[model samples]
Target chain A: MTYCVGLLLDAGMVLLSDTRTNAGLDNIATYRKMFTFEDAGERVITVLTAGSLSVTQTTIARLREAIEDDDATGETSIMLAPTMLKVAEIIGNTLASVREDIDHKMNATKVSVSASMIVAGQRAGGAMRMFLVYPEGNFIEATEDTPFLQIGEHKYGKPILDRVVKPSTSIEDAQKAVLLSMDSTLRSNLSVGMPLDLAVIERDACRVSSRRRIEAKDPDFARMSEAWSNALREGFSQIEL
Target chain B: MTYCVGLLLDAGMVLLSDTRTNAGLDNIATYRKMFTFEDAGERVITVLTAGSLSVTQTTIARLREAIEDDDATGETSIMLAPTMLKVAEIIGNTLASVREDIDHKMNATKVSVSASMIVAGQRAGGAMRMFLVYPEGNFIEATEDTPFLQIGEHKYGKPILDRVVKPSTSIEDAQKAVLLSMDSTLRSNLSVGMPLDLAVIERDACRVSSRRRIEAKDPDFARMSEAWSNALREGFSQIEL
Candidate 1:
């Protein structure tokens, strides 16, 4: 299980993901679920994955392989795609194919291996875009009305996002919103643990503007989480029945 | 789909359930999901249901029938049960049987018909208790450590309960918490909607102390929901990144 959220805001896009992966309760492990590809100034793409490790890892590896392939074309490599939409298509196709291959092999054993991803990026001279790619190769783009997309263990963290996020939200505030949302998820669910990966892409920058790896004991995150909890409790105490 | 939550506090128990019943997005109707049986002053048992309407309705019908039966005894009728635990078992068994009956009929079509219930009550000489009855006839009681139980479309409303609910929480605060929790669920999900049933039982009262059918246009509920949203947004704005 995993938790990943990406927000497309007026300032830019903010993405965050937890690193906990587990086959079962006793088989938990830490694995980075955020991947970035940059041709620095040409285009920048970040993919945050959730679901079966085998499917996500294989899909990512195939994507990286395509980027390095001598014969790679716009349709074959996300890095070479002309637009953010094309990049999403390439990633979605790769994810779907990898999932199908794995699901086919696991069919007899009745195991299910499916994965989804949040693709956020900006290409030079193109609009910044964010997409949630489905396991079946379909995808949906973030629009002004709904500026955020989340995948896996999402419900626990959703109410905060639904309340606080907006198209006009600042990049700084967006970061705070996603973190607080993740904080709620972390507190409510054991499956989504810490050592979170956070990435910010400023509009028109075509590269990740800033990034942070928030470990389990990151003091700033800890303080913010505690502060938010205190604030909520205080607010709850003040509400009239 | 439905949403029902039961909270056990030092003062007593708080239960809330939405009335929306939907077979599909296009087919929705209003139906009460909360039922109460009281031999007032002797015992009071409240059943909040979620899942297949057929199963829940039938289970309640059977429980009602047995309570009115001339031959009903401690082994069959919940009103005659010796303790709150026995009352839970009677309800659980009836629910399980009803679900199995419905499931068997729907088996060929593979249209699953499973249901679950939250039974909270107290007998004249017994302790106050709350049990979450599963579809399999097994049930788990709410303890001091975790004094809340939720069924159906639960995730959206869970974080607030996780933050505010406690065995020591006041009945007034408990009502506020469950209503706010339900507010979140209503905002995040369409399947769980208006005209909620709220019941309160004060400790050792052996009857429902107070109850309210909160309609969609209920001014007090609407005001509280609005206040909560505003408070959350204001709190969110003050948070630091």
Candidate 2:
């Protein structure tokens, strides 16, 4: 299980991903799902993944292998892709192939080897873009009307985003919104855990602007969670029947 | 689809259910998911159901038929059952039989004829109780540690309930909590809709003390939803990053 969200706002893009993976209660592990590729001042791409660990890990590994290849081209490398849309296409194709390979090996066991990802980034002199890439190699970009995309255990954290997010939201508020969204998810679901990977890519910067890894005991996160809880209780009490 | 919540609080029990049924996006119809039976001052039993409408409707009909039979006995009827636990048992067995009957008839289509229900209420001289009865004729009761049970499209509405609901919450507060919970679900899911049926059973009263049906344009409901949305935005703005 995983919980990952990407916000495409006027100010920038914010991406957050939890690092918990479990096959069962006894087989839980921490595995980072957020991957960042940057050619500072040229392009920055961040991918947040969910679903089968094997598929996502292999897809990321292959994408990296392609990036490091001497003959890496726009056809084989996300970094070399000419546009954000093409970056999504490259990632989606890689994910689809990895999933197919795994499915062929595990098909007789009635298992599904599907994974999904959120691709958020910008290329030099281009617009910032965000997409939800599906297991079938198709993708949907976030729009002004619906400016956020989430995958894996998304419902528990969605109501808040629905209420607070908008295209004009600031980068600071966008960061807070995603954190609170993740807080709600963590409290409600056992499979989604910390430390969280948070990245902010300012519009047109073409580079990672800020990044943080929030652990369970991170003081700022702890304070924010406590303050949000208190605020909710106070707000709930104030609402008249 | 449906969204029904049952809260077992120190003050009493609160049950709310939405009334939307759909075979697909276009085949939607309104069917009451809440059924209440009360021998005023003696006993009250409310059943809130979700999932296979055929199974749930059939189970409720059978339970009613047994109650109306001249030969209805302690073994065949919920009202005559000595304890709330016994009442749950009777309801569970009835639901299981109904589901099994339907499953047999629909076996060739590979469809699941299963349903889930929350049974909530009290009988004179008995403690108030709530149980989530499964399609297999088994059930689990709400406890002090977790005083609420929800079925069908529950995740969207669960975070607030997790944050605010406790066994010691006041009945008025409990009512508000559940309405807000349902409001969240209705906003996030099209399958769960208005109007909603709400019933409250006060501790030791052994009968429904209050009930209301909240339509889409119900003034109180509209006001509450508006207030809640405002409160949430205010809270979000006040939280520090």
State the iRMSD of every prediction, in order shown. 0.8, 0.7
Q: For residues A112-203, write the lDDT of model 2, one tens digit per residue.
A: 78899999999998899999999988999999999999999999999999989999999988998999999999999999999999999998
Give residue B9's lDDT in candidate 1 (0 to 100).
91
Number of clashes in every candidate structure?
A: 0, 0
CAPRI tier for the interface of model 2: high
In order of appearance, the predictions have TM-scores of 0.99, 0.98
Query: Which residue pairs of candidate 1 clash?
Result: none
Task: Tell me the TM-score of chain B in each candidate.
Answer: 0.99, 0.98
Runs of candidate 1 with Cα error greater than 4 angstroms are none
Model 1's CAPRI class is high
lDDT of 2 by residue, B1-241 (tens): 8999999999999999999999989999999999998999999999999989899989999999999999998888998888889899999999999999999999999887789999998888888889999989999999999999999999999999999999999999999999999999999899999999999999988889999998889999998899999988888899899
Give a tens-digit lDDT track for model 1, residues B1-241.
Answer: 8899999998999999999999989999999999999989989999999998889999999999999999999999999988888898999899988888888999999888889999999998888999999999899999999999999999989999999999999999999999999999999999999999999999999999999999999999999998898888878877787
Mind giving the per-residue lDDT tens digits that candidate 1 earns over A1-241? 8999999998899999999999889999999999999978889999999999999999999999999999999989888888888899999899999999999999999988899999999989999999999999999999999999999999988999999899999998999999999998998899999999999999989899999999989999998888888888888877887
